[model samples]
Target: MDLELEGKNAIVTGGSKGIGKAIAKELAKEGVNIVIAARNKDLLDATAKELSKETNQRIIPVICDTGNSEAVTKMVNIAIENLNSIDILVNCAARPLVKVLNHFHLKHRMTIFGMI
Candidate 1:
């Protein structure tokens, strides 16, 4: 059960809910500081608070839209600043393009994943 992850830091994209949240929880439980990124500020804040309390590890929440390169870059900078180092990276964000912009059509969904 010991992941030997104590004092490590991690970045979890789309970590506000579902599998990303679960991954963040496990990493936190292993004594890792977690930087969780998602588009919804409210949800990110709530999840960070909950995880920090549960795991007693530092949890940072970052508002990030992975579809944009600038946003992803900013998110990475924020994560590095908050967590100091990125020992683990979990790319679990599953963004529904349909709910995003009205006319912004993505030629490929893998573009976001490529950023990871």
Candidate 2:
């Protein structure tokens, strides 16, 4: 399957690992230039380096938290500047935690990880 993505540009958030990482590797294989974003600078940098070596593709890892709108804006600007135009934008990120409110004490305000 040819995505016709040779020399394309994209941004993959939470790309330091997990699904984001898989997408990046796949895109790189398809010849899509990618900019990976995550909150962890160290992990991002290392992942970028490794991906670059593995697929021999152009991958730039950035420390930008998607939770912050400002960071996302800056990331967009940088992507535009570097890649000129974004042909693809893959925002595959996840929040690692979830809480359920089964019994919330009005005064204490307590919660549980999983509740019915």
Top candidate on TM-score is: 1
Which stretches of model 2 miss by more than 4 angstroms? 98-116
TM-score, candidate 1, is: 0.82
Alpha carbon lDDT of residue 96, candidate 2? 51
TM-score of 2: 0.81
Per residue, candidate 1 scores C-alpha lDDT tens digits across 20-70 of 999999999999998899999999999999999999999999998888889
Look at candidate 1 and tell me the lDDT of residue 106.
Answer: 47
Which residue runs of candidate 1 sit more than 4 Å off their true CA positions? 97-116
**TM-score per model over all chains:** 0.82, 0.81
Give the least accurate 10-residue stretch of model 2, judged by summed lDDT: 98-107
Give the range of the ten consecutive residues with the poorest summed lDDT in model 1.
101-110
Instruction: Give candidates' CA RMSD values in order.
Output: 7.6, 5.2
